[model samples]
Target: MSLFYLLAVILIASAIFTITQKSPVYSVVGLLVNFLALAALYFTLNAEFLGVIQIVIYSGAILMLFVFVIALLSSGVGPFRAGPNRLPRIAAPALLTTLVAFGFLIFGIAQRPFGPLPPHRPTSFLGNVGDPNVFGSVGDFGVALFTVQLLPFEVTAFILMVAVIGVVLIAGDAVPQPTLGRHRPQKRAAEREPILKAPAP
Candidate 1:
């Protein structure tokens, strides 16, 4: 559909924007746009619960956390320094792995007969779009999340927690500077050099 194509374009453009920005703030803004567009795509697919979760959890919570981290890092004494690059060391292996994955994907697709996709509406499991009781409804999603998919749900939550913890640990005290409510004494004016010493006459 035209709507799907439009959303797909937006998704791809925003994704590219997110990665190509020089400023992290701009990148985050682009990422937020990408998330919103993804949620819209989910809505088009009738996955309302997923759309809402994508917006609420990823856009609301995770994005805000990233912004807070960026702000905290910016509050330090100087611009944050980056670690050594290992891209050169891993580039060849990464390219080989990608090619192997693509080969598998192509082989798998070749095995399946191409045919028209089934109609989207009035499915056996999901039911009609207007139905009060449907697979993608909040109640159903909750039930499934808590029952058959409980392990995956818990594992995802655990991974998110670990990611948050890792961010906190890595962002901690990379520079020796005062944090909230903690101040270091400044050097005396006499002990410090002048910003511009008077030129010798």
Candidate 2:
């Protein structure tokens, strides 16, 4: 239980850090931490295949792609706005709605009557007749992914492909200098004019 809590905390913190981080590289690192945490959680849950997939696909491949795209597109750290904005106001209602929805979901789940939980071993279907305890096994994972979650799996793969294509398209061209937002950004070190020192009398 403590391990579960620890993993959950790390995952949430890393996810928040990913979004809140200033440097894109640092953000990517934070996301990597999130991916690692998720993989660990899967391992704890005895989902070895999912843990491997999480580490290989998300942490190794996708994040490397993100880093490559960022490096290819941007020359250096660019100017960023520094001030309060309407973004929080826009997100607040959606966040509140989601929280309320989750509250209802939890309440509903808690209301269900409890039964004697199955044994600690994994469960398997008759199709793989030889292996009785094959839950989270490769065969079970493959069956579920192809049969039950086929559409979602395909959609996710398509989305990833589109993201890669989009990144390549954007990075292939010379990116334009971004215009400052409502707030004036601080001048870069090279951009600031040095003050002339007065000669000693």
Candidate 3:
């Protein structure tokens, strides 16, 4: 077997293990390993820029979010149970979606045309030597964001900001007030005696 195929097999196994793991923390670790393997695969494909993005976005940002969510929602033993029918309800839709996606993928792959790709002059050298904005450079990205796709870029940023704010608001503690200890008995207002009473006629 080729080295790439072997790596691909390991990657698929790791991904499946990550999904099926009972422990959220362990799943996150497995996902991290999967991301690293995917980055290695991207490198093998000679897509250095995409590999860096996989590390930065998937391995760094998304994994951190997952870890934070797991920590917030669970206490290591396990998370709280949902309604009895939740699994079946969720599972049906998920299975349908998966089948649909697989069908589309098979159809597309079968219909894809195979031909020699057109050759192009390398842009990397000119970008490195002539242009100040090189390929995959921050400056080039910024220019593209503001010049070509300014509105969409701003909209995406706004959506992300809203998402962050919503998460913070949902996770924020309610206004804390003084509280008696958990075991302490609560005093009833009626328990206190009236200060004054009318005299008997």
For model 3, residues 1-201, the per-residue Cα lDDT tens digits are: 276797798799889989889898889988998998898876665446667899999999999999887876765444445556676678889999999999999999889976653343223322333234344444555565577668887999999999999988876655454667665676688996777978999
- lDDT, model 3: 0.74
Q: Candidate 1's residue-wise lDDT over 93-184, tens digit each?
A: 98899899999999999998887756654232433323433647677667666776789889999999999999988878565565866676
* Candidate 2 wrongly placed segments (more than 4 Å): 76-89, 114-116, 122-132, 146-201
User: Residue 10 CA error for candidate 3 (Å)?
Assistant: 3.2
Residue-pair clashes per prediction, in order, are 0, 0, 0
* CA RMSD per model (angstroms): 8.6, 11.5, 6.8
Give the distance in Å from residue 78's predicted Cα in candidate 3 to where it truly belongs.
Answer: 14
The candidate maximizing lDDT is 1
Indicate the TM-score of model 1: 0.64
| Candidate 3 similarity to native, TM-score | 0.60
Candidate 1 vs candidate 3: which has greater lDDT? Answer: 1
Candidate 2 colliding pairs: none
- TM of each candidate vs. truth: 0.64, 0.60, 0.60
